[model samples]
Target: MKIEILGTGCSKCKRLEERTNEAVTELGLEAEVVKVEELDQIMEYGVFKTPGLVVDGEVKESGKVPTVKAIKQLLS
Candidate 1:
């Protein structure tokens, strides 16, 4: 699965990234996790807020940092 974390390197963004990775590890899914920092790329996903989560090209969450449990639920 293709998992992308969208952010401009903010604290919340970092937290999301870490939690996403933890979810991926716990799930044992062989997925690629990328950090999208470009404004154009983030806008392309129609997200105006930092710390966005994109899975398989679909925007899942944005604006707030999600907890590990929340991320695991999303990944599942």
Candidate 2:
């Protein structure tokens, strides 16, 4: 599985990245988690918000940081 966190390195974006790591660890799932910091790259996902989550090329969440449990649910 592949995951992407879209943001420009803001505080919330950093938190989301951390939570994503925790979620992946707790789930014992191997996923390539990446941060999309570039504006062009982020825009490609069609997310106007800084914080976004994408799983396997599909947008899952946006505009806010989700809890680790919530991310786990999304991953599942």
Candidate 3:
């Protein structure tokens, strides 16, 4: 699976990334996690929010940081 975290390196963005990593680790899934910092790239996903989560090219969450458990559910 591929997980993408969209943000411009803000605090919330970083937190989302960290939680995503924890989720993936706990799930024991082999996935690639990428940080999308470029505005154009982020806009391509149609997410106007800073913290967005995309799982397998589909936008799952946006605008806020989700907890590790929440992220695990999303990944699942």
Candidate 4:
């Protein structure tokens, strides 16, 4: 799975990245986690919000940060 964390390297974005890593680690899954900091790239996902989460090229979460447990559930 390709997980993309879309943000502008803000605190919330960093937290989302950390939580995403933790969730993936806990699941024992191998996935490439990418940080999309570029505005053009983020807009490509059609997300106007700062923090967004994409799984397998599909936007799963946007506009807000999700808890690790929630992210884990998404992973599952």
**TM-score per candidate:** 0.97, 0.97, 0.98, 0.96
Q: What are the lDDT figures for the candidates, one per model?
A: 0.95, 0.95, 0.95, 0.94
lDDT of 4 by residue, 1-76 (tens): 9999999999999999999999999999999999999999999989998799999999989988899999999989
Error (Å) of candidate 2 at residue 4 is 0.5
lDDT (10s digit) by residue, model 2, range 1-76: 9999999999999999999999999999989999999999999989998799999999999999999999999999
- Candidate 1: residue pairs that collide: none
For all predictions, the C-alpha RMSD in Å is: 0.5, 0.5, 0.5, 0.6
Worst 10 residues of 1 by lDDT: 65-74
lDDT (tens digit, per residue) of candidate 3 on 1-76 = 9999999999999999999999999999999999999999999999998899999999999998989999999988
- Over all chains combined, what TM-score does candidate 3 have? 0.98
lDDT comparing candidate 4 with the true structure: 0.94
Model 2 root mean square deviation, Cα atoms: 0.5
- lDDT tens readout by residue for model 1, 1-76: 9999999999999999999999999999999999999999999999998889999999999999988999999999
User: How many residue pairs collide in each prediction?
Assistant: 0, 0, 0, 0
Model 1 / residue 17 / CA error / Å: 0.4
Q: How accurate is candidate 2 locally (lDDT)?
A: 0.95
